[model samples]
Target: MERSRYLQVALEAAHAAAEVIRHYYRDGVEVSIKADATPVTRADVESEEVIRRAISTAFPDHGFYGEETGSHALDAEYLWLVDPIDGTRSFVRGYPFFSTQIALMHRGEIVVGVSSAPAFEQIAWAERGQGAVLDGHACRISQVHALEDAAVSSGNLRTLAGGPRWADWAQVVQRVARIRGYGDFYHYHLLAAGRIDAVLESDVNILDIAALSLIVTEAGGVFTDLDGGPVTLETTSVLAGNPRIYAAVAELMRVPG
Candidate 1:
């Protein structure tokens, strides 16, 4: 299939999931604790189902890896990564920070992505080799090269706070002009649209960051694991930023002896 078609399908899947999420958002749903201690709701499961159906109908041969439904054919040439609701806790609390995340990974590369924040009224999409778009306008990361002039955002820092790099993280906080924990999809969106210079996170699943990673990279920013490694299925940490800020942050995050 054409790359544009992949993005089209991803957007459609995100939209379909958004409908399910919005309905549950307004009407309310019961939450259950997953074994990982994260919360899940009917909205999450039903939304994944709807997204899966939409993608399957469009390309039955492709694989699927979803937060709710789990994986199928992960090694397939083409795979769909779905996160029905990226911020369930916020959604449950009516905070409107939740979103539907959908991405297509082709031959181990995330070639397309669609992030739809229904409640937030924001949508961003990207195709590999093409630029990113946020709400119908092309977007790019900020050019703030110096740490003292850059704004950095973080998410899910529990692991970082407990690890050897805790001081390194502190160094980043002390050096940057501003720091905010805009956790979940919001920070990535901000980074991609030139609103923020960088985003760091120490605990995340592939489903959580895959789409956002593509969005950031396509927006002329770099996306990598905290170790400065390429993104892959096992990726759990992130250090994303505009090219210059990314290099600066990545160097600061290196583990100290």
Candidate 2:
């Protein structure tokens, strides 16, 4: 695997943010509803602050787009995408699945990523051409190519039901062998670990998908938006998995004209 200084910086930032998340985890951290109706906690803000400071100190001119702090230098050639605490609901409930995700985008392409789950003591990271690692071990996606033999997961059903593609998504559920709603950062971890074949989710933000996108793809999996498009800041949905499974799911997820 190739080594990179920037990837190291991303790892350091993610680890630094993890400490803040652990401090507030299940400690009655206060939460507020954002304008988008999503929950944000003190941990989220503090964690994002930690990440921003770490990265900026290392690369002062790099842009940052964080879930809590919003965007900075959006037009800069280098952009750091941060999701301080993905699955905030799970964090508030003391669930172990929430993760801190950080990714570096160079000229609009994500080049490095880290997904650190504080409670689980697990960290997954990847750099382009460096493959991926989970908890110090090399990672790879499952080779399961057949949908009928694949275990699938999605973002919460209620969330998808309210979306325009619910009917098309349902077709995916019927085609796969098993389905679980193990939404958020954790699902990508599972996909990279070869524990599941695919994950389909809608209404995702760039911060929610950036890190996991690189991690999964580097782990020999595919990552793309719901329509089989590239995952980007404008992406509102995602369908990710091993190459074949991704193709199958994306086909099933396409809404009819």
Over the stretch 1-257, how does candidate 2's per-residue lDDT look in tens digits?
66588988888888888889889999999889999899999999999999999998999999998888978899899999989998899999998879888999999999999899999999999998889999999999999979999999888556678877788887888889999988888889999999999988877888888889999999999887766678788987778889898888877777221
* Pairs with backbone N, CA or C atoms under 3 Å apart (clashes), candidate 2: none
Q: Model 1 compared with the native: what TM-score?
A: 0.96
What TM-score does each of the candidates earn? Answer: 0.96, 0.94
Candidate 2, 211: how far from true, in Å?
0.7
lDDT of 1 by residue, 170-202 (tens): 899999999998889999999999999999999
Backbone clash tally (model 2): 0
Candidate 2: 10-residue stretch with minimal lDDT: 248-257
Q: Name model 1 segments beyond 4 Å from true.
A: 1-3, 255-257
Model 2 TM-score, 2 decimals: 0.94
How big is the positional error of residue 169 in model 2, measured in Å on the Cα after superposition? 2.4
lDDT agreement of model 2 with the native:
0.88
RMSD of each: 2.0, 1.9
